[model samples]
Target: MKQVLTIAGSDSGGGAGIQADIKTFQELDVFGTSVITAVTAQNTRGVIDVAPVPIENIEKQLQAVGDDFDIAAVKTGMLFDAVTIRTVADSIKHYNWQRLVVDPVMIAKGGASLLKEEAKDSLIKHLLPLATLVTPNIPEAEALSGIQIYNEQTRRMAAEQILKSGAQGVLIKGGHGADPDFTEDFYLDQHGGSLVLRSSRIQTKHTHGTGCTFSAALAAEFAKGKSIEEAFLTAKQFIQSAIEHSLNIGAGHGPTNHSAYRHYAQKEMIRYVH
Candidate 1:
């Protein structure tokens, strides 16, 4: 069985962060492992508190994983400060791991930030260049590029800037800025080619952990030996299905049902097949 690692913060709510990454890995048939950088008290409403795990402990956890498994791929979620980001980046560099997926987890669904302003520079300057793919939502793309991405044109520009910053690839997600009727995601390859993926907007509040889930699935598919384009396509489909079947439970924004697509969508299949 292939193994995938997620270096991130733990979400106490069990809906996003490390918890969501694990669920995504499991759903995609990959063994999930983690090195936690912080712990957050969070729920649908918002994050109540966040405690950055000591940098030394974070480093030790990462090292422990490296020693045990020939880690297939790695996807990172939240590194709260400069110290943790620097530490994780160096550890990843030390291992020279393959297929690194960096989810620029800047803020939570409810606008609670999971990363420090100071750490942002280090993440872009150090970690991103080493990644096989960098996944960022609109705001995250803007933060990294230092430009406000207000529409499709600016979104492309942001993706280009991030790519120029040394990342091998970039996925500028459109969940935050898409038209109410459509959702689009962009991917830029190392060879200077790019692809755009669009989905019909699902009206719901269960959008938590979407960034973590998408990036993790992307890494999982790559770990299982799929091509970057093939992996990106499969991961995008999985995430869209997950979002469409989200549970309408939480008061604010709920979580997607991770097991949603296990069984086929018979009705839709029939509708399309016929």
Candidate 2:
């Protein structure tokens, strides 16, 4: 089986962060490993408090993972501070891990800051250059690229700027935009090739872990030897199914059902194979 790593925060909520990533990896049939950067006192409601793991321990976790497993791909989410970001970058370089997916997780659905303000520059400087693909939402893209993404032209501009920052590719998620009909995610690869994936918007409050799930699904697909475009489409479909079958549990933004895609895929296969 393929192995994948998630270097991210631990969401006590089990709705996002490492919890969500692991669930995603497991459902996608990849061996999942994790290195917790921060522990957030959170639930479906909001992030109450965050305690960042020490840099030394963070390095040790990376060392342990790199020493044993052959990680096929890795995704990063919620690196709390500049120190954490730098440490993760150094560890990735040390391992020489190339299939890196950088999910620039900035804010939670409840409006809590996951990435520190001071850490943004460090992420851009240290991590972005090493990323195989950087997945940023509209706000994150605006912050990283200094381009306000009001429409397609500006989204393209923001993605181009992020690509120039050193990542081989940029996927700007358009979920936060004012578009009421479709949730369109824009993609731009290193060679300037672009693709836009459009999906019908699911109106619901349970869109909490959608980003994490999407990136994790993409990593899982990549580990299974899918092309970037193929992985992108698979991940897009996964998120759509997950959202459609969202778990209506928590008070605030709940979680997307990770197993929803598994069931959907099985049904799809059965229908086609029959």
Candidate 3:
């Protein structure tokens, strides 16, 4: 099995962060390894507190993983501060890990700031350039690109601005969009290739780990040597299935079913335009 690594925070609820990444990797038949950058006291309701892992310990964990595993791909999420972002970026450079999926996790579902307000610049400067693909939701894309996305034209402009920041590709997720019936994600690469992926929105409050899960699945697919377009399509299908069969275990927003893709693979569908 191919090995992939997730450098992210630990979610006490087991819905997002490292837990979701590992679960997604397992469902995709890849070996999952992790380096926890922060630990959050969170549950379905909201995040209570977050403690970032010390910089030294974070570096040590990365070293341990890099030394031991022949990791095929990597994904990063919920890096709380500038120091953690720089540390992760340096480690990725040292290990020469090329296939990197950056899930720019800025906020929790309940409006808690996961990434620091001051860390945004560091992420743009130190990390974005190294990313093979950067996945950001509508808000995050606005923050990164400094462009307000109000329509399809502005969305493409924002993506182009992000690509200028050095990421090879960007996927502006549409889950946070105003469209009530359908969600559309826009993908743009450095080579001028673009794809618009659309799927029927599943009405549910249980989408806690959707970003983490989708990016993790993308990394797993890349680890297995799939093309960028192929990986995005598969990851889209995976998240749709997970959300369609979401688990309603919590009182607040619950989590998407991590294992649902395998069971519903034949039933889920996503439409894309190249």
Best by lDDT: 3
Ranking by TM-score: 3, 2, 1
- Model 2 residue 98 distance off true place after TM-score fit, in angstroms: 1.7
TM-score of each: 0.94, 0.95, 0.98
Positional deviation of residue 11's Cα in model 2 after best superposition, in angstroms: 0.7
**Cα RMSD (angstroms) for every candidate in the order listed:** 3.5, 3.8, 1.0
Give one digit per residue, the lDDT tens place, for model 2 in 113-224. Answer: 8888999999999999999899998999999999888988999999999998799999998789898987788889888888887777889999888889899888888888
* Candidate 3 TM-score over all chains jointly: 0.98
Tens-digit lDDT track of model 1 for 84-168: 8888889898988889999989888877878888889899888998899999988899999988988767877788889887889
Clashes of each: 0, 0, 0
2 against 3, candidate with superior lDDT: 3
lDDT of each: 0.85, 0.88, 0.93
List pairs with backbone clashes in candidate 2: none
Order the candidates by lDDT, highest first — what do you get? 3, 2, 1
